[model samples]
Target: MNTLLLIEDDHRLANMVSEYLQQSGFTVQHAANGLDGLKVLQSTAPALVLLDLMLPDIDGLEVCKRIRALPGALAQTPVLMLTAKGDPMDRIVGLELGADDYLPKPFEPRELLARIRAVLRRHAPGEATEATHQTLKFGSLELDRDARSVSVRGDVCDLTAYQFDLLWVLAERAGRVLSRDQIMEAVRGRELEAFDRSIDVHMGRIRAAIEEDAKAPKRILTVRGVGYVFAKQQD
Candidate 1:
């Protein structure tokens, strides 16, 4: 069973979510505040974290930043942010801070379950099972499918699981301009929401991690009205 840490302040909501997730075959751990959540995170090894944005002690964004700053494997752990705030900025900021996915409050349990599964699938191991440990190289950038790691020059690029997957999809189809809908379908196996900008947020994060200059990225180029394309030329 996959262990999941749920950091939520509302007791009733926490109980409901935990019961639902537990029924869905996850080992759920609950924390009522950011400090407790951080402590639990340090002590337990969860497959994923369901972080609530509004915590009594410290905000979830700070917890996310701290989580990403952790050393080794702990740092790369997938996070799915939960928020009551419907602001696009909050969702963008959460994704920018290393959240693999985000779900707003008053969400259906089924939708939440789907998001969890999608995020977990993105983080699953044996990604190169059919590729035979292949590594793609573009200039100084290196992507190892087996290890699911990306490195620019000789240094590792810090990316969340979702960001890495998004980059991989674009790089694998280098030179092709993928519309947001197409990209979302390819990456998430779902249609793009009418006004959702999560993909753009994730792309920005990916560029920041791998590009020498994110402001004028050469690797992942924006196509303005259409979408984005990963440059085929390395040099």
Candidate 2:
């Protein structure tokens, strides 16, 4: 069973979510504030964190930044953020902060469970045996699918699990312009919602990690009003 640390300040909501996730086969741990959440995360090292954006103490974004600053595997742990704010900017900020996925509040329990499972699957090891011996290369950037690792110019790029998958999907089809819908479907097994900018946010994050100059990216090019393409010629 996967363990989950839920950082939420609302007692009633936390209990409800905890019970629901527990029934879904997760060992759920709860923290009412960001400080306690960080402590629980370090001590328990849960498989995934369900972070609420509005914590009584430090905000969720700060917590996420701290998590990403941790050493080793802990830094790359998947995060699924929950927020009552449905603003696209908030969602984008959360994704930019290294959240694997984001779920706006007023969500169904089933949707939350689905998001949790999807995030976990992206981070799960031992599922890449089929591609164990294969590595994809684009210029100096190397992606080991089996190892779930990426490096540019022999230097490792710190990418969250979801970011790596997004990069893989793009690199695998280098030079092809992929619409937001197509990319989302291929990577997340889902369609893009109207006005959803999560994919754009993730793409920005990916470029920041792998591109030589994020402002004038040469690896991933924006087609403006269409989507994006990974340049075929990296030289």
Q: Rate the local accuracy (lDDT) of all candidates.
A: 0.87, 0.86
Which residue pairs show backbone clashes in model 2?
Answer: none
lDDT of 2 by residue, 113-204 (tens): 98888888778865566645768887898999888899988999888887888888888999899887777777763442534577788888
lDDT of 1 at 161: 74
- Candidate 2 ranges beyond 4 A from true positions: 127-132, 191-195
| lDDT computed for candidate 2 | 0.86
Q: Give the worst 10-residue stretch by lDDT in candidate 2.
A: 188-197
Query: Across residues 1-235, which tens digit of lDDT does each residue of candidate 1 receive?
Result: 3999999999999999999999999999999999898889888979999999999999999999999888878888899999875677888888999998889888999898888898898888764666487778998999987788899878988888778778888999999999887777777634425346788888899999988899999999999999999998876
TM-score quality measure for candidate 1 = 0.95
Report the poorest 10 consecutive residues by lDDT, candidate 1.
188-197
Off by over 4 Å in 1: 127-131, 189-195
